[model samples]
Target: MPNAVSLAPAVSAQSVAPAFHEPLHTAHDDDAWWRSSVIYQVYPRSFRDLNGDGQGDLAGITAELHQLADLSIDAIWMSPFYTSPQRDGGYDVADYCDVDPMFGTLDDFDKLTARASELGIKVIVDLVPNHCSSEHPLFKAALTAGPGSDERAMFIFRDGTGPDGSNPPNNWQSHFGGSAWTRTLNDDGTPGQWYLHLFDSSQPDFNWDNPAVHAEFERILRFWLDRNVTGFRVDVAHALVKADGLPDWGGRPDGCSSDGYPGHAAPMFGQKEIHDIYRRWRSVLAEYDGDRILCAEASIDPLSRLVNWVRHDQMHQAFNFAYLHHPWNAAELRGIITDSLQAFDSVNAPTTWVLSNHDVTRHATRLGENNPEVGLDRARAASLAMLALPGGVYLYQGEELGLPDHLDIPDEQRQDPTFIRTGGERVGRDGSRVPLPWRADEPHYGFGSTSGGWLPQPEDWYTLARDVQQTDPDSTLNLYRSALALRKQLRLGAGSLSWAADYMDTDIIAFLNNDVMVIMNMGESDAYVPSGTVIAGSHADAGAEGVLAPNRCVWIKLN
Candidate 1:
């Protein structure tokens, strides 16, 4: 049965479906692959588990390369699998050069990278430069080295303000929650100076002002580069360089922007000094062959400010958070797409589009509101819209399967620091990071041999498994595969986009790219289907004559 929405109008005669083909994408410099590539974000712990350890690992990722290659993506960006305490989901790096025991060993990563290369897919690992795990040797040494020691200087350490030095150095709030500062115990077992942690207390922010810190990260980068990894997705890229003498932002602990920041002008992020770090990284990447890349997870706003990080000399790509966080409104999306293109064009950089990731709610749940069916339809429609944009795209794992955030995750099972820090006031990101469903009838939906992985999978996920969708043309997985195949065939990622004429006043998003016109109806009622040959669509009724349903997207080839 077609995954058609109830609101879709009855089908009449089919439109004149066209038979046409465009030349393959134009050739560019070897290092320019990232300019228009589709990179998949693999959340290691939840993707697949081959070891039956109840968590996904490197070997599991290797086992799934064939499936990823089948999707036609250019690369895979795996979230951190480094040796860590697993606090903050491996963002807290305990050892930069080794893999966590739970994930696998260094040899496992080597084999995974080699297998991925054989399938023509490049690998990009996560680099957490903004902070390190408290269990890291350096951080551990810093804690015992006292306030004024060189070991302590690697991180943000400061004297308290009160007479007895009891108060925190500043009132900055952590992204995880509560005070950003955590006091330590001196050698004599007395209350020592406070150290800063912009995220969880287990992850202490590094002081970029220290030259040794810079040298250490450079060494760590080379360690992986020598291992033949393509590049890195720099974690917390914008927050690496804080303002001189970290001042209080006066922003409340819970006051976060759509991109999860305390406003764009927060003193702790987007500091000018951050560019120097990227420039250095770019230089480091230039030393290696194969066009190694660096993608920044910078959430800086005002497209103008965010563009600076992707300047020709700095980083290859910075995520387009503005576009990701926007609602399903046609006008809003148009403005953001236009603004993003213009802003990135000014810097001679490609705008990266992403809808969901490890940190945020899945787009299906987010766009659907209370209606599961509506959300799935809109999510599919949104994917069509995002893929039509001209730039790099980062697809979070399992998004192709139309997975909703596991919103019913039990409170006791929640592990995100945000949940613990906020005392359940905010549910945190555990829902988005749940293990993926690969097989309908297998144990844990084929994630592992057990009943479930770390976080529980929704019982209803069986219907959405890849094995079930592979045979259904109208399934979300099939929709993504068809759209991706077309994207590559027509080279849409490298094509130019222009707003189609005549629909400017309507609630429909109509844009033309090369010989293809992408139309999405975001209005309350059915709208006229544009006159053309239907090529692909987000819904089964997309090829229907006369009208397009609300939250439906279709690609048409000019007659």
Candidate 2:
């Protein structure tokens, strides 16, 4: 039957893709591997423990590379494990070259890289460039120099008497709360200048305007590439460049001061100059051997701006946060997916999808808090929706096990800087950072030997233990394996595909790619699709008619 729909032929054995063989610098090779890559994020603090220190380290992660390999993940995007004062849980990096003591030494990191390579899993580390800890040597030098010093220019330092000394140089708010600036004592016992921090006071903003800063960052990038790091997950990538001249962000209606220090919206965070910075970074990454991935965590609203980050020459893929924050509903889910595809199509850039991360509440907790069965079912559906997409897909740790957020931490035990400064009005991130359960019947739930791990393990984690799930034929782990294998066999990432919104109405979203129709039932009731060859699904058997039960998904191949 020669119908309008036909399956695209697989890549020829002799016709090599340009990205795989060419140097990364060539336009033909940029963003080559990511198109089909499935990235698995590992939050080190909670992944595993090797030394019995109650904290996960490089050795622990290295030992578990086989586990990731068994799941068929192509790459691992690890959160920052750099040296830090633990102010922002490793986000505020003090040194880029060295591994944090708590995470083991540089040798351990190298061994982990080698082990992951052996398992065919690429390693991507989080790169924090926008800011450094207040204790960083560069910031310390600026503090001692006071005003009119060369080292002081490395940061945004303004004297108290900016015009009249009554107002800050500009209006900007810290993300945590209150002003973004903090005053320190000068060597002469006089009022010292104020330093700016977009996040917390302890994380002082870097003066990217300084050439020294640019050169240092370039060196850091090269250092990692030389060590065989597969790529980087750029942290707050859009915030790298700010307005050359600090300006007032106008007064806030919430009664909080909008003065440039913190808490107020400022235009400098996403300046146009950011593109130039990215180009320079990309140029350096080109020097590497393989197709090095660059995933940006640019928290920009307005889907159009987000698409810009993934254009031909920009980031390989920028995090799509629409699904993370959207309300769980049939219409909302359909709209987000449709809009995302349209936005990416408009820009000719591939799209990426992430349902949850360490920063946000667990998806299970968000959807299953009231009805566990429904929530788990919905979680499975969401995973299917994301995996079937055209571009890359990211799976946060414990997502496969259906782990929910654990919010039983005492107020005094809180560790997140956001919670500490906000006074508990907002839920902290501790709930999502709990240890992974390796065994259901172990005394400590197989997290570690200690009664209390780095973060408290959820009581419910025992049921979702890795050992138990490995044995269950219908477990989420097996489902992920099946989905990944199907995707690989189809080679959809390298094929030309088009989707129509008319077929994707509320409660049901259907899209066609390379002769494959992905039908998703976002509602609670069963849905039907025209008969086709079933490629993958949650059902035990695939009948001629594609009937999907509540929160079910099926990929059908049309002849």
Candidate 3:
């Protein structure tokens, strides 16, 4: 370990128990913190390493709870840290009840949870119910149980087509590429049965049609919830249920052609059965005292269809990813924001906004065209704009420090199954999954007890290390801190958004959220900045007295 440092966030009463009092912002004025909390996501293996193992673990996370507390966040959403074969970054879970050796033991997880509760940070974990590691005991049992046996019924196993069962059972393709079905060999070395995998062959899709499968997941959820896990972020939330008979999607064009719905749909996704599963899962959460939440990573589009996943008692929130996936443009943003807020409103569910996460390119690099200066500007601009709109927001771990994607990651250092499976034609997500820089000048940048990080961080990351950024008041780190403080103070998340149609600058996006003036200058020239007491911003840099510099967003208090 890195010496015996106290893992507690702070020594205050607020950090120890619920007895401590803190000012509650308007929107979050209610006890349902899930509706308005700012959740910080920490991707394991890339977050911090406690054992000098070059991989992040629970102890490392416990050590950093203090830093997260300083950010004024209500909870931390952790990506998968369960037992896995590491095929899909822990998404391919081999066991649901235990912790992976790489992430530390269940005892370490208990200590981390206890420390987090003391720090007043609720913990949420990633739940990959759609698939499990092919090495799971159930899969092993299925492998030995022969065809048409009870052990094999929990997973989708079918006989192949063509003469002598030589071909795959279906025409479906794995989202990662190649055939979705993988044929296993019998004791005599004959091709036995084909099992379905939506992503990688190492992850076998469960047979949701089997009641035993549903019961197994319910037991798993309760196991975590019993350990005081506040909630779950369901991965592939829209894809649990496949269409009847597993039809071929190869002929149809990509997107919402199957159901003729307003949103994108596929035979493999947005199925009606998925909602019923959540409804059942919701009942399971109801058995607990705390208002446990289920957040969906449903990538459904066109707010209307996506809204269904968040209806009344289903998932408490579905990620509004359509907003994140939209191109950085004025009209596109306005429509998405309006539609999202309105659609979720109809269902009485809070809309969850996330700009970056473990799976994609960091928003900074996505907005910037191989230009750091331009990317940081746009990234900061979008942060305030999203935070001011209302409801809950998720912050990817390094995002507050303005960390950009490490686009030039060496090919050999890449470990993502996507990259390996595709033969490097696609770079995979390794660029965005680099270990976070902590101490400015420390070896391993304070990630572990060594100089080399698991994935090499960019050379310039020292400039954006959390330690350096915290000291620089004008840094993006400080900006996020200030904005979050202001957001809680002003009850911004409790408000409504209205367009300032009177502003004539097409390059600028101006709006009001509960009487707060929000202006984002997306143009080359400075746009006229409406007057109000400036609260928080990307920076204080200005052009003229009443104009905002290009690619900056400002929040002004309404008089």
Which residue ranges in model 1 land beyond 4 Å of their true spot? 1-31, 252-264
Between candidates 1 and 2, which one is better according to lDDT? 1
Whole-model lDDT values for every prediction? 0.86, 0.74, 0.81
Answer with 1 or 3, whichever has the higher TM-score. Answer: 1
Runs off by more than 4 Å, candidate 3: 1-31, 251-265, 542-544
Candidate 1: tens digits of C-alpha lDDT, residues 342-378: 8888877888999999999999999987788999999
Candidate 1 weakest ten by summed lDDT? 18-27
Report lDDT (Cα) of residue 180, candidate 2.
Answer: 71
Q: Where's the lowest-lDDT run of ten residues in candidate 2?
A: 17-26
What ranking of all candidate models by TM-score puts the best one first? 1, 3, 2
Candidate 2, residues 328-419, lDDT tens digits: the string is 56566656766776787676666787888999887776766466676676677677667777777888988988787777877777788878
RMSD after CA superposition, every candidate: 4.3, 8.0, 9.4
For every model shown, what is its TM-score relative to the native structure?
0.94, 0.88, 0.92
For model 1, name the residue pairs that clash: none
Model 2 residue 355 distance off true place after TM-score fit, in angstroms? 1.0
Model 3's number of clashes is 1
RMSD of 2: 8.0
